[model samples]
Target: SHIIDVIECKTFEDLLATTQPLEEYLANAGCLRPLRRLEDKNLLVDDILMFQVLHRVRGPFERFRDGLRTLGVLDKIKGHPESFRPLLCWSPTMLTADLVDSLFTINLSPVGSNRRHAEEVGTQKLGTILAFATGANTVPPIGFFPQPSIEFLHQEQDTATPSKLPIANTCINCLKLPLHTSYRAFQENMDFALGNTHGFGMVKFLIVSHY
Candidate 1:
């Protein structure tokens, strides 16, 4: 059975803190190539649940340093000369603000895909977080993994009984409701909304900014 650590956070620190335990727990559990869900109850099959931190949780990144330090998660990857694999999860508001282009000032306009949006957000806050951490002469350059969506290994709502799966789109999982997902087309509505790529970007962008 796979386990999911679903953690909701209001700050970057909280987000980083939550991930540490998850990293340790999963690493100890021998979980390699963590899996994630795309949309609906669909997962990458055998992957760890990644309730990733998003843009909205920004402020005083120092809070995350300790958790990261204790876990050595960042340290372990410092010399690899790479960035965290990109993910399309949350989009920040600053980049998508109505006046961002002029009225609002933020690098990288927030548009299309949740993962890229979050990457931009992380970039701003990471500077502060890394500076506060330790043994810091310079920070590793982090880049976003450009893709359509974030990797989400959605856990089965119920592990006991099996349920019928829709042969195609247009069918909702009767067994799961509130948390269950439905598809508008062949693609699973990951964000569970009534829109396409544009819609997804708008919705996720709002979420990353505010929440």
Candidate 2:
């Protein structure tokens, strides 16, 4: 089920290009409120997704235009009151990186009970993937999630680390091993290593059979 949904969305465009809008997809996937919907909201979830996809994939100027087009407020303010016109006439040039950052960055830096709540809700996995895809990095609390202790694993294997998960914190479903490593050998090695540990919990063991 996880594989069918969140895991399949490898990129922002992958999500946006889907026939089902990402907001709807996420809403279906259990994030009831995908984006902060304010009372004065002019953009729908699809519009926001389109703007973000364009903003990231296109040039800055193109991104600005795309945002305006997606918002659809510009056209509606043709002959409105001066007060109403100012509300719609937002200059795309004034778009700050922080504003874009907020769009994708959920509560990544949660503390105490919030941190525990995130773990309970599987936010570590979901939030990590989303934040990484959208380039929103925030330090996670230490030992927030479990990780494998593989010596040969690359430090920069995934750009979304430093989430305070332990060493060798790769993707949620990945099990990293050296090239040409056999499945049996990897299994035997894990069995031996894990046998020594006291309480073994849920661990995904991935053995790459090919180099």
Candidate 3:
């Protein structure tokens, strides 16, 4: 039950100004003192701060975009293999299918998702995620997670226009839009394994193992 990493806020002043409830959560929880041991064992644990969670969810979108930001952040560190980042997100969730091809992103997909179960739009997205991750014609596994089955909301999520200052698109595919790079070609290659895979709150502390 050791957490592998955290993304700390930019500054104490900024965190305090934006997120008082989170400040209170950390202060009352005394999380750092109890987790010091786990922190010592995992090298990358020192790289991010656990407190960043507060600021990210302080306001609107009810932490939905914040959750996406967290997952996207996990995607960015796609090259780090020492540990994996487990996260909770609200909506418009993505699977790690595109990431596994990189030596780094493989660790991120402990459970895996697949568009094989989907039809139409969902299937297409999941397919894109899968093919991009595998780097081959071979279809990857797409099944339910053994424990904690996925619970997707029936309503389709509105694309919360990215927060101007905070959640700008980080997906390499997203960043390429300006260059007029053909994103459709990239889309055709991914596996959008849609399961209970992308959204889980309690899984955060389970991201890394002790031994």
- Which candidate has the highest TM-score of all? 2
Rate residue 116 of model 3 by lDDT. Answer: 29
lDDT of 2 by residue, 1-211 (tens): 3223433555555544442445564454343333222321223343445545554457887766667666675555544557675664665556687878777846445556766676655434444432322222343555323432233443465644321111123444233333324766644554443333222122222222110
Runs of candidate 2 with Cα error greater than 4 angstroms are: 1-180, 199-211
Considering summed lDDT, which 10 consecutive residues are worst modelled in model 1? 166-175
Error of 2 at 104 (Å): 30
CA lDDT of each prediction against the hidden true structure: 0.37, 0.41, 0.33
- TM-scores for all candidates: the values are 0.14, 0.16, 0.14
Worst 10 residues of 3 by lDDT: 162-171
Residues 43-84, candidate 3, lDDT per residue (tens digit)? 323322433455334465556556646757645555553444
- Report lDDT (Cα) of residue 102, candidate 1: 71
Residue 40, candidate 3: Cα error in Å is: 16
RMSD of each: 28.6, 22.7, 26.0
